[model samples]
Structures are given as structure tokens and as C-alpha cells.
Target: MLNSTQVSYFTLGAYFDTKQVKYVLFLILLCLYVLIVGSNVLLIMVICVKRSLHEPMYMFLCSLFVNELYGSTGLFPFLLVQILSDVHIISAPLCFLQIFCLYTYAGVEFCNLAVMSYDRYLAICHPLQYHALMSLKKVALFIAAAWITAFLIVTTTTSLSFSLPLCGNFINKVYCDNYSIVKLACSDTTVNNIYGLISTALVVFVSVGLILYTYMRILKVCFSGSKQTRQKAVSTCTPHLASLVNFSFGICFEVLQSRFNMSSTPGAVKVLLSLYYVTCQPLFNPVMYGVKLSTIRSMWKRLFWVKLK
Candidate 1:
């Protein structure tokens, strides 16, 4: 075991055996990253410029788009660089910082989705009071709270990780993750583990529960209401629900892989699972929302048509 002070770098072992296909993987990821950024930015710009979209639901959608950009920026740039490099090494500070950004991204995602669910619940279930319930000021506050709370919560986890006396420097995965870092610690990580559970339950599980509750209520109202109401609800709710399920699956799969012993799992499978959350969600959110939401789609068409003309 090396002294904690002497261990300034950690080696990433997930990319160890993929040297032969690094360039191929690099090109694929680069294109995907560009698409995620381009699509997200375009949607965000449309929301900001179009006065017709100045509503609570679109506000929440804007926040979601920006969050996707934030999360992907934290990861894709570093990942692109690593894909072309021979060695997969990260400094200790950078490793922890990456963990902080990525973990905070996940937490903020849950919060944003929870808030969006609330927005939809208000809009559909209590249409008469939707405007009063979700004013512009209130929406801004919710977005701010989502970002601030995530930072504070992840700050605790990252600080705890920084204090650990690491006995090893090899991280078995591609990116820096909370559990992976803690697993390398020389000392017992009881506190980190307990704190991790508490944070996950508080942030991920609670938000997921809230989203499910909102959807349940929405569904009930849809069934009780007329056909037009049902159609409207389906049109609005489909994209949000799809985004939620996509993100939840990615996060859950990564968590399950981390918690269990999957040594027998093929390396290729492991790589795919690891990349799912960071890569897919960023790309998925913009595409889902931009195409599914009617207002955004119409606005997009007009914006492009005018640009071309």
C-alpha cells in the first residue's frame, strides 16, 4: 500500500484491453457527443427566443435541456480525450472532481424530473389553478433549488471521499465514480457507504417515487376525463415519461452493476452498461422532448424554415 500523500494518480482499468478499437470508439463517441450538444443547444435557444413558449412547462423543459448540457459537458470532453490516449490515468484531484460533477449531475437530474412531474401534475390535474400554482418566479426558484441542493449533497459525498486513505490507485471502471473511489480506500468505508445510501435514497428514490405518484394521478384524471383530455394528456406526458424511464434505467443498471459482483460479465457488456447513463441520457432527453412536444416541434420548423429562406 502506498502512502496516501504519494498516491497522486489513479489508473482507469476499464479501457485497458480496447486499444485496438480506440479510434473507432473515439469517432463514434465524438459524433454522439456533438449531436447531444447541438440538439440540446438548439432546443434551449428556441425556448429562450420564442415568446409563445413562456410557460411553466417549457421553463422546466428548458432547465432539463440545460442540465443535460451541463452533465454531458462534465463527461464527454474528458472521455473523448481518454479514448485517443494510450494510458488511462487521472490525477487524484481531477478524479474526485469528475466524481463530484457526474454525481451532482445525477442528483440534479432527479430533482429536475421531480419538479417537471409536479409541473405536469399541476397543469393536467388542476388546470384551473395551473397558472397560479406555477408562476414564473416559482419556477425559477425550483430550478435554482434543484441545482443548489444537488451541489450541497454531492459536496458531502465528495469531501468524504477526499478524506479517505487510499490503499490502491486502480479504478476498475472507465470513469471516476463514488463507489469505485471508496472501494480503493485502505480504511473501512462504513461512513461513506452509509452516507451514500442515505443520499441515494433521499435524492434518487424519493424523486422517483414522486414522479410515479404524479403520473398515477395524471393517468386517473385522463381516464375520468373526456377523449380530448385524454389525448392532450398523452401528448404532453409521453415525452416526459419516456425521458424519466430512459434515465432511470440507465442509472439503475449502473448502480446494480456497481453493487454486485459481475466478474463473469463480458468486458464489452460492462463497457456498454457503464456508458449508458452518461452518454445516452444526454442524447435522449433533447431528442425526446424536441420531437414529442407539439409546440416545440412547430416552433422548430418555423425557425428552420425562416433561417433557410
Candidate 2:
């Protein structure tokens, strides 16, 4: 729905004039979204039902999957529709909701990763007091804290992101995104850009950096001891490590590409980069968690009608 006042720009290479190609792409995206939802839901179900997975580490991973579903669903479906229809119109209120959902999930995902990393650090570095320190009640408290922190971060980002007036109507990207959304605002976004920088630093530099430092210490402890201890440490933390690397790699790329790369990018590069966040992210989480953890794989098998009995 385009108003008389708002100026809408046509994004090249995605004109929805052709019926066949649009429908085909829509079908493909719908399948991918279904696959993502199904996989993450199965991951959650397996963790809940399987007695073997009721541990601190898997709990963190379960939360991560849930948040991933939240983040991906926020934009991917709408984006698919926009691309298929070749209409990029979005109402102002709906755009705010999109930012809220995306920011919440992203913040929660960051906190959950940090929490998992710390849990691994404790388990690997302190074999003796691990049980007492990472008890069920303590894990619950940590999750609660993560949720609260995520809420606050989301509140701040949303308040700032959405409060700006939208005199200029069009968002440049495929979905309701931070960069594209900000560019549509009527006012100067210097402060918003600064906040974006801070947010990126907080996630990539502060949270992941500390996690890496802890993992390094944990690795030191693992390699110094007996062979069995080394193997066990690697086994316990490997899934988490993989997830951290997989997740952080994309985020770091986003930060650098947005902030540092001063070159003028073409439309194809924009779509490809945006697809990394939307399409690649959901797929990565399931593969990393499901493949790395045997329990999750069994659950995933059961989910897809594979007989486990």
C-alpha cells in the first residue's frame, strides 16, 4: 500500500513481473522455511523428551534453537512474499514489530551463546565443583537472566530504531532490517549508527571474545592432563565450540561489511549478503547442533518419521 507522499524506489533484478519464476522462488523459500522450522522444533522436542539431554549445555543449545526460529521467522516469510509479489511496500507499525522480533531474538541468541560458553568453561576448567556450580536451579537462573537481558537490549534497540519518523518511505533491503530500515528515516541517523556500532562490538568483541578466552583456558587444561581427560573435554565442548564459530563468523562478517567496507555494492551483493543472514543462519544452527550431538540426531530422525525403536 503506497501512500501519495512516500517515495518508493524500485529494487533492480527482483521485479515480480514474471509469474513462473516468482512462483518457483516462492515455493523454494517456503520449503526452506518449513525445513528450518521443522528441524528446530524437532531439536526442541528431543531435548525435552530425552532424559539424556537434560543437562546445562543442551539446555543452552535448546534455547538457542528457539531463538533462531524467532529471528528467522521475523523476516524470511515476508521477504519471500515481497520477492514473489515484487512489491516492497511495508506499513510503518509492522516494520516496528519486525525490528522488535529481530532484535529480541538476536540479543537472546547472543546471550545464550555467551551463557553456553561460560557453562563449558566451568565444566571443562573445574571438574570437581562443576556439579555444584552448574546445578539445575543455577541453570534456570542463568536462563532467566539471559531473557531479562535480551528484553532490555531489545527494548532499547526498538525504542531507538522505531521512534524515528519515516518521511522517506522505502526500505532498501528485502526485509525489515536495521540498515535498510534506518536508511528510510526522515532524520539524521548518526546516533543510530553509533548504537549499531556499540551493539556489534558488544556481541562480537565483548561476548565472543570472553568466550574464546575461556575456551582457550579450558583447552589448556584439557591438553595438559591425561589422554582420556583431553578427549572428554573436547567431546563435551565441541558442539558448543562449533556453534560459536558458526554463529560468530556470520555476525563478524555483518559488522565488518556494514561498517568498514566503503565500496559501493551492487544489488546482487546486497541480496546475497542479506540471504546469508536469513537463509544461511537457520540452516547452520540445525546442522551444527544435530550433527555434532548424537542425541539431537536421534531426535531429528524421530521427527522426520525415522523409526528409532
Candidate 3:
């Protein structure tokens, strides 16, 4: 483990030495990154050009696409380089920064998804107040809050990363992460690990809870109204629900994979799982929302035609 306080350090482990799938994995990840970025970029261009899509849902989606872009970026490039290079070298500071970027984007995106889900809740459950509640001013404030919260979480996470001392094992997953990164330090990862678990659980639980609760309330309100009202409410909430379910599944997979025993964990598998979190999951957001929403489709067509014109 290399000490975080040390001016510098060298990597100690080989890349999946016996694992033959490294090249295949690298190619697969590269393809995923391209699609994730391409899809989100297309969505952004669509919203920007379609004057009719100047609505709250599309605006929220635009924010999500931005989050997915940064989220994937924080981890994929480094992973791709390391996989292709056969060189397991990364300086401590650079590693920390990488984890910081990854965490910040992940945090912000989680909050934004909750906000989007809540917006849907309002539209379905409280039609009378939806416009006022999700007004431009309120949405702007929410966006600002999402950013502030992202920074605050990053501060806590980074402080934990910097405070830890690593010495013996420097191996980590392909996707750089706070806990895995901190484990590289020779010192005890107890503090960092515990902090990660608590922080992650709190964030995931809270955001997921709020979204679920809001939807539950929406279902209740819909049930009390007409048959048509109930069906419409379900239709309105379906996109938000589907997106939330997928997001939850990704977060759950990451939590499971990241909990390797610090003493005997395999670095190669760690890298593979980390790659899954960083690379495989982000496009899920764009797929769930961008493809399902008709308004987004119309907006895309209009935006592209306008651009060509």
C-alpha cells in the first residue's frame, strides 16, 4: 500500500494476469461509452433545437443526459487506457481525483433522478399544484440544490480519501472508486469504508425512498378518482417508475461488487465490476427516458431538421 501522504508511489499488481478476457472487456466497454455518449448527445441536440420541447420534463431530461455523460466520463477513459496498456500505474493524487469525479457525478445524478421522479409524482397526484410546484423558478432552485448537494457529498468523500494511508496493496478495479481507491493506501481503510457504506446507503435509501413514497401517494390519489383518471395516472408515472427501478438496480449491483474483502479481494474482478458500474449502467438513463417519451421524439426530429436547415 502506498501512503496517500507520500509525494509519489508505484503500482504493485498486474492486470488480470491470468484472465484472458481483458481485451474483449476493453472492446466491449469502448463500444458502450460510444453509445452512451452518442445517445445523450443526440438527446441534448434534440431538446436544444425543438422549441416545442421547452417544457419541464425535457428540461429535467437534458439535465440527466448531462449527468450521464459526466458520470461515464469519470471512469471509462482511465479504465480503457489501463486495460489497453497492460500498465497498472496511476499516481495517488490522480487516482483520488478520478474517484472524486466519479463520486460527484454519481451523487448529482442520483439526486436529479429523485427530483425527476418527484416531478412526475406532482403531475399525477396533484394536478392542480403541479405547475406551481414545478415552476421554472422552483426547478431552477432544485437544480442549484442538486449541484450544492453533489459538492457537499464529494467534499465528505474526498476528505475520507485523502485522510487514509495506503501501503501494501495498490490494486483496484478498472472503474476507479472512492473505497477501492482508498484501499490502495497502506493504512486502515476502516474509516473510509465505513464512511462510504453509510454515505452511500443514506443517499441511495433517501433518494429511492422519496421516489417510492411519491409514487405510492400518486397511486393512491389516482385510485380515488375516475377509471380514466387512474389509467392516465399510471401512464404518466410509468416512465418515472421505470427509470427509478433501473437506477436502483445499478446502484445495488455496485454496492454488492464494491464490498470485497480488503485482505484477499481479486483486483481483476474488482476492475471488471467497477467497469460495469462506470460503463454499463449510464446509458440506462438515456434509454429509459429518451426512447419512451413521445415529446422527446418530436423534439429530436424538430431539432435535427432545424439544425440541417
- Who wins the TM-score comparison? 1
Clashing residue pair totals per candidate (backbone < 3 A) = 0, 0, 13
Best by lDDT: 1
**Native-structure RMSD, model 3:** 3.4
Model 1 lDDT per residue over 112-170, tens place: 99999999899889999989889999999999999998999999999998888888999
Per-residue lDDT tens digits for candidate 3, residues 205-302, read 78888887887887788778789878776655676677666666666666777674544656655545545545655787677666667666666666
lDDT at position 211, candidate 3: 80
- Name the runs in model 2 displaced over 4 angstroms: 1-19, 186-190, 256-266, 297-309
User: How many steric overlaps does candidate 3 have?
Assistant: 13
After superposition, candidate 1 runs with Cα above 4 Å error = 1-4
Lowest summed lDDT over 10 consecutive residues: which window, candidate 2?
Answer: 7-16
Q: For model 2, what is the alpha-carbon lDDT of residue 48?
A: 89
Query: How accurate locally is residue 66 in candidate 1, as Cα lDDT from 0 to 100?
Result: 88
